[model samples]
Target: MLNNSTTLVKGIGNEKAKDLEALGIYTVKDLIEYFPFRYEDYRPKEIQELKHEDRATLIGTVQSESTVRFFGKKKSKLSVRILVGNILLTAVFFNQHYLKPKLVVGETVTLTGKWDQHRLTITVSECKFGVLDSQGYDPVYSVGGNITVKGLKKMISSAMEQYGQIITEILPERFLTSYKLIERKLAIYKLHYPKSFEDAKHARRRMVYEEFLLFQLKMQALRKFHRENSGGTAIRIQKDDVELFISNLPFPLTIAQQRVVKEILRDMESPYRMNRLLQGDVGSGKTVVAAICLYAAVTASFQGALMVPTEILAEQHYHSLKGLLEPMNVTVELLTGSIKGKKRKDILARLQSGQVNVLIGTHALIQDEVVFEHLGLVITDEQHRFGVEQRRTLRNKGQNPDVLFMTATPIPRTLAISIFGDMDVSTIDEMPAGRKPIETYWAQHHMLQRVLGFVEKELKKGRQAYVICPLIEESEKLDVQNAIDVHTQLQQFFTTYQVGLMHGRLHPSEKEAVMKQFSANEVQILVSTTVVEVGVNVPNATIMVIYDAERFGLSQLHQLRGRVGRGDAQSYCILLADPKSDVGKERMKIMTETNDGFELSQRDLELRGPGDFFGSKQSGLPQFKVADMIHDFRALEVARNDAVELVTSEYFWTSPEYKSLVMFLEEEGVLAGEKMD
Candidate 1:
């Protein structure tokens, strides 16, 4: 089996493996069992079911010879008339002059596609000629780069042909019998080339169970490790101190905010280390919950650190924390890559001397020079932006400071459980009273003038607007409008409006200046990329115009829409999309129909799948081989139960099979030999 694993019959080289690895396939184990994401059935249909306008797969014998017709300077198109008993249909292939010789007249062929008014368009996708008709489901392998549907099908067939019986059964026999799961050998065979729809269904079920079970087992192990090894940082919370801080707040706390603060306080009272995730929508008062935690730490004579994703977010957190905590004489210090000179030195000195009660910054907060004084609480805003190592680095700054990670991106409950398996999650679902949902619209390019007029009207009313483009500059691959070009165009067209440009390429200070000007209403219209997605909140801003809305994922469009509707007045989120494609129309429809982030996220997962939604850059969620995040949710739940049971059982660590699994996990960076410090 080991020998069979390394050698491919067609002989795959390092170059091919490297390309596969780029798509997250690293080992033979990953490739052989890589199941198809979806399937399309290509069974021949009866002539009675065939509509004039509908695309259908039909089986018939050609009655005459094929002929090619060419226009001047254009490649010829091949056309053939076929007869199936009483029905006659024309099969057409475009720009394929060479097909005339291969597909001779009077040959029986199976073709699939829609029939136009007169011509039946040939779909070159996996059609078989002179073969027995198939009447069931067909698998569609998720192909990428150089791997085409035809090529992948061939490779998979070859792999199965060579290593038919050599495949090892990884799961223990006893467990397999107990779960009623099929053998790994049978599962692999049917996954790639199933004999029937029932076989494929069973194969998918077994594979999904295996992936979910393994993933849940890993999380359960981590949870158990934390439960046993995590030494709770017990802080004596002065209820008076907490109440005093809350009382001094300029605005009253929302019920959700109050609930989260209470939960954090309870966690701080525990002797176990606090590993909590705070998830909230935009403007849901997460910053305030964080400040309450900081106050608790300070009142206990300990320090807390807040780390944000970007310098701008760090700055925003700093000011917000300062405004709330400074009144109580708690010193809030700001740190980032941008801070330098004497000011930086002074902040570090104060931090080391325990003068700074709370420090807020970007990744610079993880640097060796940034030492904390009695750091007891570590809070990371937008925790997904930081790597596991980076977050651990900051946490290790103190003796295993209680870690709290926050996210503005709202995820569904099932996703939260699977993704953040190790951390206790707290959600702030309710927005504060007086906040309004951003009225959203989906429009075409032709309506740009009307959208512009609306923006002008808002500006005339002393409000501000944000124009978001997906790209920073022009791209040959993507012809969408960009920030730089849009800025210039707006400046030329809306000559009276103060338009400012900001993107990722700008210097930190430059971006900050542009944001400040926009916040101060110096710039009535801010043209930027998603850089504005996280910062520069202005109550006066009532409009958010996102160009190329189809270019963005639903979650992203939701986040950009969150920029507006933060204030009291009615706000609008205008999504401008080129609605030519079905996907484009569906994406825009989701934006206009729903304001609930959770619903949108689920829809996004269903439409775009988990890969593009979590994205390559941030694959924080465990990649499952067979578990569909949207469809196989029940399997996920079952896996969750099994994981919890295994972890709680005494034999989990003692069992040899689990030991091997643990070692595998450790090597994958999902688990370490010991608990995280």
Candidate 2:
């Protein structure tokens, strides 16, 4: 019955059903579960007790006859003087001329609107005849597509009334009893028609918990399935050989790096497949750790593959890894979209023949033509840049290979668990030895002359600088500095120095050429967009000037700042911005105070929210209707723990207590067609 079409609800026909479907409500269950975004409190209050600008309900008797006056075009204003207690208040309604006939001089009426204390006026949004007998709250739905809020509310109420009783509880009985949660049916009813704010709060809590628990249960099930079904080849590498390789490296591993490497190696050696995330700040030596793991797999007579988002990043990894591993007799090859003809064929043939011990490339690595003989370890750099399916495809190329995902973007712990719950997380918290923290400063556009003077000093010292603008071209709507204009300005100002321009609009080869010039000190100043935010590494660059820095998120500012501090020289990041909004100002302030990407990421989540934190692609974070991952993180933690416990139980799938949950998971397609054994 709950699965019946929404047309089954009263007052809903084919057209109405289409409107509801536009809102993602196709079935009766979806209709009832479409919870109100907010509620309007219609509880009457005295004018004296209500604050100015408060949305309040007032009960009063009409002291004056309602007057209607026509205004601009079809607009009309209706006003009436209502007397409550000893006070006379004016009630004004816009475009509600029909109320004039209903407002009798002595009749009592209810008015709800914004209250103006100084004027003793109620800008009435809703006016009704007679006072309410008791307090009431109206649920407000976010409606669209020819469906009014009133219509959605009516449809949802009808659906709940008809099918609420049959909405089975998916949670186990023990959980409900232990958590002291109300029944699912009551919760659904209260969510749509809450008698009080407390009732609404409790109902929302129940729904949030249920949503999180179900999601975590799915994660737990996926983790368990991967561990059991995706058998991993235990890479038999001697500890002495691993130690010898680490000791031979030019740089010693930091304590944090050592710990993370140990965790990754353990996963590789275990019988279960490795599903891990390596999170480190920019220039934190994550690539070195990945190199060690790749070496381990290669030494164990298995091929290794590394995939990145961009061609330049792939080539950069290829050159660095070749330098590091080639001496160890590890045959390394690069496969990118640019590699063509005989070169590409030779690499593919070598990969298939098990001669290419390690292959590095962009999306070309996932192409059907590329095959590996004994692909054992798969590592993806900047994992968030690739879509979920893209990453999965690369992993599928190899048979249950140990997979490690590396990202320089530090995710908050709360988000990591929610988004990457199935994968083991290892964070490199320490920067490499002798690396200097970049000094960050915020400035307004008026201080550009002084900032440029400072940049000139750095250039005079034979150091390079990066000038970043938010836009590639002039935006007619936004009055901000653009890369083209900035590049032209810098070129004119610093005529003696070579200033190379780069933006997303540039071809990949063109961008790579510009980057190479900057890296080789041929370009003393690089004026580019945020394309330099990720993989461009120039240790000689000591100054970073970002115009309209407030337009960028905190995490992005951090990434751009990271490009400079890679060298031993003291680096500085200058933010030229005069933000009009408080959030923008706060972001600039936060960037200047710390270089901790994780800390900045948390603040970014709080300021810009999860949707904008990762720049539109939420990186696979589940969307919850009522549950806010940031605010309701405690609930998420609780749900995750509960899910782990329940999934680990021997009778989770077969027991009668969990039958409803199992059925719900299957019905919702969360189980992915996995059956009970």
Candidate 3:
């Protein structure tokens, strides 16, 4: 019955059903579950307790008959004087002349509207004949497209009345009792028609927990399924050989890097596949750790593949890894979209014949033509840039190869668990021994001359500087510096130095050439957008200037700041902006105070929320109707723990207690390929 079409409701016709469909409501269950965005409190308030512009409900006796005055065209204003507790107040209504008969002198009336304390006026939005009901809260749904809020409320109420009892519970009785959660049917009722704010809170809590628990259960099942059905061939490499390879490196690994490498190697040696995320700050040597893992796989006569989001990153890794591994008789190959004809054919043939011990490329690595023989290790740099399907495709090329995802964006532990719960996470928290922290400063636009002077000084010392702008071209609505304008100005100002501009609009080859020039020190001052946020490493670049830094999020600013501070020289990141909002100012302040990407990411989550933290498209975070990943983090933790416990126990999906949960997961398509039995 709950799955019946919403047309079964009392007042909904085909057209009205179409309108409801705009809100993603087609079935009776969808209608009932469409929770209100907010609520309006219509409880009667004392006149003395009312503040200026307060939306309040008041009960009073009519002191005078309503007077109707004509306004513009069909518009009319109806005003009446009402007396309550020796105070007289004016209640005005617009185009409600029909209510004049009800507002008779000496009659009691209840009204809800915006109050003007100075004039003691209530601009009535709603009027009733009697005192307010005990249930004073009215749920406000976000409605549109010919469907008024009143109509949506009516349809939802009808759906709830007819099918509320048929709403099945996904959570078992034990969880409800243990967590002190209300019944699903009661929770749904309270969510749509709450008597008080507390009732709404309780109902929202139940829903949030339910959403989080189901999500976590899905994650746990994924993790379990990946582990059990890994089909991984354990690569046996001696610890002594791994130690020898690490010792052979020109630079010693940091303690954090060593620990993470150990974790990766252990997972690789196990029969179960390695599904791990390698999270590190900018220049924290994540690439080195990945290189070491690739070496381990290659030494065991297994091919390794590293996929990055961009061709520049792929090229960067190709050069670095070739330098590191070529001396050890390890063959490395690069495969990207730009590589074509004979060269591309040669690389593909080598990859299939297992001659290419390690292959690095962009999305080209996931193409159908790219095949690997004895492929044992798959590493994706900046993993969030690729979708889940893209990563799966690369992994599918090999039979359950150990997969390592690398990202410079430091996600907070809470978010990492929520988003990457299915994978084991490793963080390289420590920077290299001699690496200097990037000195960040926030300056107003008026101080551009001073910031430029500082950049000139750095350039005079034979260092490169990056000038970042939020926009590629001039935006009329936004008063922010653009890359093209900034580049032209910088070129004119610093005529002696080469100033190159790069943006997303530039062709891939053009962008790569500009990056190469900047990396080779041919370009002294590079004016670019956030295109330089990742993979462009120049040891000589020691200064970064970001115009309109307030336009960027905290994590983004942090990423832009990371463009510099790659070398031993003292690096500086100058943020130029006069932020209007307190949040923008806070973002600048936070950036200047610390260079910890993890700390900045946490603050970014707080300021921008999880949706905008990594961006919704790349975030891999689930969109929950009631549960906020940041605010309800504690509930998520609880849900994850409970999910892990349940999935690992004897009574998992096969048990009668979890029958509803299995059904729900299957319906949600979470168990699409899973063996339920």
Candidate 4:
């Protein structure tokens, strides 16, 4: 079904097929899965029944039509007064000259849009001329690129009629029956053209479940494969060495940090190579716990490498670890892409000769030429920043090296287990002593004066502040200003203080310079993108202002808030968010109510999705077209349980029920770390 192209369907010629392919519909099965993004309730309503902001469809006869008022030659406004029974309903059209001629006196038409009760009018974005009745609950596909909505609907109808029966079901029938799931064929049919809201809801449930089930099954397969292949002779843990390193610390480890260290040590002592995830909130001292484990590996006559997402993070970790380890006679070195010429060769020689016991670097550590002498342990700091292949490549440098993955993403326990089932997870939930919870406030656009006044007050106290702008998608124009614009505006606002700007487009050296200036308090206010959301340590900064806070996920907002409250003085996190939606306001409300990273993460998963939780390129989650990790989380749990049971049962590999599923998972390439299917 997936192999056959859409060109085979009736009415879809080569030129039309090209348009369909642009919408990601290439095959017959692809056309079938191209479900509507939304279902418009075109069921006509009475004129008096329409409330403010009600997206209503009104069916009535055109009683009168105004002369076309031209704003431009192609752009004109027409006000049509439609009579529904005795009441007159207004329909306004903008730039639709073709519709003006069609709206003659005493002609029936259906129009749908948000109704303005005060004005008693509705904008006619979508309208259909009819003689009889209105179409109820119409499918609304995202149509563009020369294919009209009617044309796309006709193509879908043709494809379904010709090839719907041949569409193979990937889920096993036995498993579906056990779970009481809706049938695959029925779900697909109802998803595209459901008669009622309940039917659409059930169809969406089934499809979302199928998406999660396939992902979990592949992850389970990958987990099995990794355990089989990544196992090696374990390096014995040197307790005395770990203790000496821990004792050298200026501060004591929190109970959470100590517990996580023990878990890592235990995993490394096992015969199987350690594949563990170190999770903690910001300022949770997870790095120190990782340090202890790396020290243990070094003491056991094995070289260790720790790679971070950014050079700033790498430099921070290097200076931090070097200050602690070099005093103990452990040779620690930093290797990055910037290290070149004689300096790069010297570092490489030192690594090969085991002169550097603990090597910490950025992306350069994973390069093929940077070979190690006895690379027994590999650590990836901020694991999600690096892709799947990168982690595997770094691990392959050693003969089945022990892998320790670290993240400050503060994932909920259930989500962590569901997504990273391939690795054992250890979380540090407690923060170090002397840290304070950031004082959070939610404000609107009108409160800009008061919020900036607060920032000025803080700056006057000789402290610094961070201003972060929401990540704007290139395709979507953000209503609020961007980082550079905000920086420019704030410069004039805070003329007495120095302000700096940082964004993704800045060069590496330029970014380092800006960050260095900010850290040194030379720049009293630093305006940056989400790049400063993690691993940026400036204890002097006591204020964080996020513009358009509703545009970001709760987890990211929480991380940004964490930038402050690291110092002794009280810090403030002011959110300048004025969302046009109630849902967006609700997200901001959640941020004001909690400071717990775990709670925020769980709420974030519920409010949106894991895909939207971070940038698409950095989320580290498999791309599932239907499954939203936020709303369809129950499906993830169900899939995880079912996958566990299926692998334990005899039907995992040999049964006909699993054939199409296995093939589909293999085709999706969901698991890239040492390929499972």
Candidate 5:
């Protein structure tokens, strides 16, 4: 049945196939499964339902011949008056000269489209050669170049009608019954064209459940596979060394940090490969905890690899770890994309010989040539930036290195399990002592002078200011202003203070130079994009000014704000918003009300939903339909508990019902990272 299916056949010329390949579509199966984002309820409306104020769909017939109006373009717009009983509604079709002939005079037609009451017009869609009858929903695909809703609907209907039967039932019958799952083929069929709302609802529910369950099964399978196959290299560390490392720190470790450290130690001692995730809020002393683990690896006489996302972060970690471990006689080397020539060769050699006890770096560390002499600990800071595959490469650097994944982004508990099922979890929920809350404000354009005045005052007081812009380049589509323009403008505006620019487009050296100058108090006003949102900790910088603050996500804004308030001085974050739109008001409110990144993230999750939760380039978790990481948190928790209970029970991997699920996970293992498909 699958072999004879339409989904198995290609439907394009060679040239068209190449074009489709650009969009990552190769086969008929890809096209058929490319489901619509939403279903538009464009079911034909009754004539009696029509009102002057409300926008309604109205069926009509052309009372007279349609006319075409041609401007500068070759194609003409069809201008026709649609008749709904005695009432005549004016309708216009743009770039559709062919539609004029289709709307025959004195012929009845059904128009299922939006009505403009103010303009007194009806936009026709699905204009069948008949009067209005029963209503039904229609599928609407996400807009692409030249892809019309009508065309998509027709293609989808054709695909389903011809190949729907061939879509194999992967889930076992007993499993379906246990989960109360609807039939796969029936759900897909009804989803595209449901006879009733109840049918649509059922189909939607079934699809959502399937999406969640399949994803869950995949993660569980991977977890089991890794545990069974991979043998971990456990590093035995003396308690005295870890305690001494902790005691030497300038500040005391928070309870959360201590708890996470204990968890790491526990994992290090375990026989199984330790895949643990250490999640904490910004400035939650995660670095100290990581440093302690590194100390443990050094004490155990094994090399450690600390992988970061960016070169700047690598440098920062290098300096930070060097400062902490230099006293303990543990050598730390930094390796990144920026490290080239003799210096790079030296670092690589040192790493290879195990002369460098702890190696901190970016992607450069994961290169095949770089060898580790008994590398027992693999710590990946900011796991969101490095996907599971990326981390796996780093892990494979040593034979089953105990992986410790760290992230500043504190996700909700339930989401953590779904995202990191292959890894054990540890969370640092506390901030170290003397950490002051940044004073946040939602400054409108009208208060720009006030914000500038505050920056000027801070600058005069020998403190630096960070002026953050949303974008690097001006985009006509987006309302957010650019950092380059802001930098140029600020240089002129604040002639007394030195202004520096840093963004993604800048060379790594140039960025480093600017950041160095900013840190040294040479650049009083550092106008930057979100590039410095994470790295470069300058306590001297007390003021943060963000332009078009509404354009940034809540967590991002929080991260940006985190750049300031690192010192003893009272820091302030002025959020510049456009007064015309209430766009950034919620973000501003959240920023002002709390200094807690977790709370702000929760609020952000509530407002923005889970689609862009971990940013566009999705990381750890599989794409979930009904399981919202924030809103549907309860459902996620239930799923997690159910999964855990099942995994712990005799029925986990041994059960017959879970066989297909394990296979699915093994198949999709490469893609499931963090909310990534």
Candidate 6:
């Protein structure tokens, strides 16, 4: 029955199914799992109870209605007046002509919005034609495409009624007894149209717990699979060689970097495969740690490859690592999409010949033509930027290579333990010596000229600056400053200095060229978007000015701020925002207070929620419908423990009691290439 098409439901046709498909609701199971993002309380109140700032819902009869346009054809309004008992309440709706027919004179309707007592108007942000009472909380689903909110609700209700009998409970009885989780079907039933807030909360808890459990179980399964596959070429620990490589480096390794290098060495020498995350804040010497790992592997008579997200990052790593490793007689080669003719051919040939001990490149390293002889280790920078499939493909090039994932994006300890539960995490918490923290200041629009002057002063001192805006070009719908407009303004202010523009829309070569100019201190100022948030390192750029700072998340703002202060020169970050706005004020305060990324990440998680904190997908955490790791962190801990035990237990592999879970997990795409049942 769950296999039935949405067309089986009343009022749903081919067009509706196509729309539903856009939302990934292709079957009965999919429809039920597409839970509401929020709820709307439909409790109606009397007109006499309405106040100036009160958000209220009132049931009344329409006494008068008219349409008016203020500016153009697009600027339309539907003026409506209704009588609740003897009190008259007016509602003004802009550009919503569809309400005119439904809201006829003498017809009773339920209108919900903020009341304007001075004008005696209630702006009709939401209104339904028929008068209705509260059925507790009405769920508001995420709907788009050609599907309307009401239409989605009706179809989901129909699907549940028709297929509820076929909705099998996958969680075993032991889980229910141990965890006190609500019944699966009951949770689904009440979650869609909850009887009360209490029931909704319970249902959400059950679902969230289940999602985290499954996610943890999947990770454990991947871990188990990797362990069974046997690590490719384990590189034994070589302390003297690592020390020599560090001593030969241009800069001294910090205590944190030295500690992490030892940790990585331990992982590489282990009999099992190494799945480690090397996390560090900006300029925390993560690259240096990765270099030590590469050097360790190469010295053990094996080849190592490093993959980055962008060509510029690849080039930076290639040059930096080459300067240090080549002195030790280790051959380091760079290969990228931009490399052409004999150069690319030579790099590929060297890799196959096992002559290139260390290879650095972008996604091009995963190409079929790029093969590694005696490939012992694979290292990835900003690993989240590459998808699981891409990483898997790259891993396939070698024989179960020891994998090391490096990221500068800081993850709070709580999230790291739960998200990267299967992998060992090593953090470089200390900055290198002589590295100065970027001095941050919050500024309003009035400070634009002052900030420009500071940029000019920095340029005069022979240092470069980066001005980051949130947009590429002026959007017709948004009011934020775009890079293009900012670039134009900055060019006028810095007449003698070069001001370059770069954004995601720019061509790859153009972006590379602009970055090179900035890195060489040729571009005095580079005006760009958050595309520079990740791995474009220019130590010469010392000043960072962000426009409309309120629009960016705290973590993102921190990343943008990281672009500066890479050099020894005292750098500054000027955030331009409205100082009065709550989000703006709070963000500015937090930024100016500290340079601690983990602390900022915790605050960011608190403010933006875990799903949006690092973004659901990019953080390598699977999407959870109602579960928030920040709010339900304890639940994640409980689920993770239970999942780990269950997945690793021998009983789970052979027992009939777990057959349904095995089948469901496989169907749910959590098996990680391992089949069950």
Candidate 5: give the clashing pairs: 218-665, 619-673, 619-674, 620-673, 620-674, 621-673, 621-674, 621-675
**Model 5 C-alpha RMSD to native:** 6.1
Across 562-666, the per-residue lDDT of candidate 6 in tens digits comes to 988877789999999985577668888999999988889989888776677776554555567888778888988888888779888999878988888677667
Clash number by candidate, in order? 4, 0, 0, 0, 8, 0
RMSD of 4: 5.9
lDDT of 2: 0.89
TM-score of 4: 0.76
lDDT (Cα, 0-100) at 409 in candidate 1: 91
- The C-alpha TM-scores of every prediction are 0.81, 0.90, 0.88, 0.76, 0.74, 0.75
lDDT tens readout by residue for model 3, 357-419: 999999999999999999999998988778879999999999888889999999988789987
lDDT of 2 at 25: 86
Check candidate 6 and list the clashing pairs: none
- Give candidate 5's error at residue 349 in angstroms: 8.8
Residue-level lDDT of model 4, residues 1-677, one tens digit each, is 55689888888899999998888889888888888888988878887887799988888888886557888557788788888778777889888767878888988887877898888888888888874253387788888898889998898888889888877667778867876678888888888888889988888888888887777777777766667566675888778877877887999999998889888888778777878888999888887887788888888889889999877788889998888778777899999877799999998998999898999998898888898999888899988778788888898888888889898889886578666776678999988988878889999889899989999999999999999986523335556658877888899999999999988888889998999999889999999989898888899999999998888888889989988887789988999998878768888898889888998888887677666655566444676666666667677888888877775567776787788876765676643555531
lDDT of 2 by residue, 298-401 (tens): 87898999999888788889999999999888999999989999999999999999999999999999999999999999999988788878888888888889
Per-candidate Cα lDDT values, in order, are 0.81, 0.89, 0.89, 0.83, 0.75, 0.84
Record all residue pairs in model 1 with backbone atoms less than 3 Å apart, i.e. clashing.
Answer: 55-113, 55-114, 232-271, 232-272
Better of 2 and 4 by TM-score: 2
What's the distance in Å from true for residue 399, model 4?
1.6
Candidate 5 per-residue C-alpha lDDT over 335-362 given as tens digits, one digit per residue, 9 for 90 to 100: 8877789998888788788898999998
lDDT of 3 at 176: 94
**Full ranking by lDDT:** 3, 2, 6, 4, 1, 5
